[model samples]
Target: MHRDTASQRLHGDLIGQPGSRDRLNTPALILDADAFARNVARMADFARRHGLILRPHAKSHKSADIARAQLASGAVGLCCAKLGEAEALAAEGIDGLHLTSPVVTPPGIARLAALARRIAALSIVADHPDVVDALAVAAQGGPPLTVFVDIDPGIHRTGVASPQEAVALARRIADHPSLRYGGVQFYCGAQQHIQDFAERRAAIVERTDYLSTCLAALTAADLAPAIVTGGGTGSHVIDAELGVLTELQVGSYIFMDREYSDCDLGDGGAKPFETALLVDAGVISANAPGLVTIDAGLKAFATDTGPPAILAGAGESARYRFMGDEHGAVIGPDLPGIGARITLGTPHCDPTVNLYDAYHVIRGDVLTAIWPVTARGRSA
Candidate 1:
């Protein structure tokens, strides 16, 4: 049972003691350190074997320590959902940050510009001329800001609608002195979670076809992207096969959620990554027959992807259902009584992680360390 003095100082008395996994406050985020390390190594190896740069999305874990581990394990850099996340990671000396989402507001642009000057290398995505112009104006007199033209892969969420628009934005970024055209970002966010492997592959093929058109347009204008970065955990293998993406911007692979677990690998196999993240909860009430309530529910995990799965404890027949904002019902034969502990797997790792303040790092049954979710609530 060893405790780091820095962790104690930062977390104060709230940090749990070593070998105190059972005593840890319930409904806390639990990270299986071994599985996490293996996942990092597996993805790194996958990227290396495929000759693709691995820039794991930090928005998944949001822990600077986890980002460090990914980088130490051969990740080229990190991708963040917002400027605040990039700033938080940069504060920890984590360089090579890419803001995946566009920053159009004045304050966000200013922050992005300031961060570009401070970090080793900072890049951001833009899909509109106004955003490109704003970034160019904000980056004036600072280090050259790398800009990725975001192309819509039919999601129509934030990217440019057409390849023509993507080309136009790329030309604008290239024309701007303060901006450097990094490449194109074509992420089909909706297609990332397609359950069937064949369907996922087919979807990516269609997306990549659109991407090829965008790439062709860029090339025809003498604005070939140096990098074509966009792919998630579900589509990394498909993306590699396409041979278009230079870097994989995957996030959830480090912490495979139940939703991701349900996604078919196209080969009729399980997901490539391990389930490294879990929620440790305690049975608070077992008053009912064959049913018990845990201390985790909608407030503890994200509900967008459905209820969290009961990974361990409460017997083999255990089933979990959200009862309310702070309670979950465990129904099954031989249910664990009050005071029993159970490990619940998240439905969606990204939003589920955002609900926690820190991660309780566990090695086997011992609580080894606690790392703050530094970028938690940094969705700007």
Candidate 2:
């Protein structure tokens, strides 16, 4: 009964309403269509200018609509952090998905094998010999599986630690009739969020040296990887400058969160991207002096980076705070009126997007599209 309140069925219902956002239920995820398209075009253009492959990470938006737009913009494919995420996108007619993480669980490998049999093309990474062996067995009955050596850039998250190990893994993968040695995936996640572009570049340069050592070893052994993939929104500008990765698995740039908004991408403190994603919440109670309660709280946003930063419909002094699972508080000299809408920039975009079921795409004041978060809750 309250699904309408959540805007679950408002695709064409908000076409011509004046001040349309004011009528939305609190805690709605909205995308500024114009800003979003600009971000997409800018990234695509950058990739083209540099002659690099672009496989934008689908784990960021999780919406097939966004994925389709990216493919049309000339992205080679999309990268999924999880196999289930790839499946969700594939069910919506998406192909050319590369799984970036290694799958080790017995049940997971079985599912990966089954998924490989049906999809047009699927690739995965392996950090250990056991994982490569399992994949080789799983691919025997399906189409040949492309396997990449997940190279560790001094971070043990998932990748082969040494160049020798990478070469060994590549040889093993190549020897298998059902396994094709694809390339390497080296990603230093912490480096991407360093805030200061110069510091981030210094860190990435160090990691690139380590990756270079691995690549040299692979090349000397005649096991050189053809497609090297890794990088994220925070480090895209730097990654392009370095020229190591043949392909970029950038995630996050499409929706500038509070974190990315603060990132100095060497553009003189201005990010190359704009904040296109926002959460619309409404004031529920203004009884407290200088403070008001809002409908969006912990459940409405991702808390890993901190509280959302107030965007629109709020005064200069506005500061947001999480009050509970279903409530938040805004304190400022000037607060929004009761039942008035407020926009927010999430601290982290990827996880915050996972919390929503759909994106309410808007152009000016009109709702243009209601795109489902195709891979939401598909993190397995």
Alpha-carbon runs more than 4 Å astray in model 2? 1-6, 10-12, 15-18, 267-269
Local distance difference test, candidate 2: 0.88
**C-alpha TM-score for every candidate:** 0.95, 0.96
Tens digit per residue, CA lDDT, model 1, 1-380:
22243434544454346557777778878899999999999999999999999999999988899999999999989999988899888888889998889899998888888888898889999988988999988999988899999888886788998878887888899999988999988887889988888999998898899789889998998989899998999899899899999999999988899988898754686557789999999999999998999999889999887888888987888899999989999999978878999999999999999888888888877777788788889888
Which residue pairs come into collision in candidate 2? none
Candidate 2's residue-wise lDDT over 96-129, tens digit each?
9999988899899998988888788899999888
Deviating ranges (above 4 Å) for candidate 1 = 1-19
What's the lDDT for all of these models? 0.87, 0.88
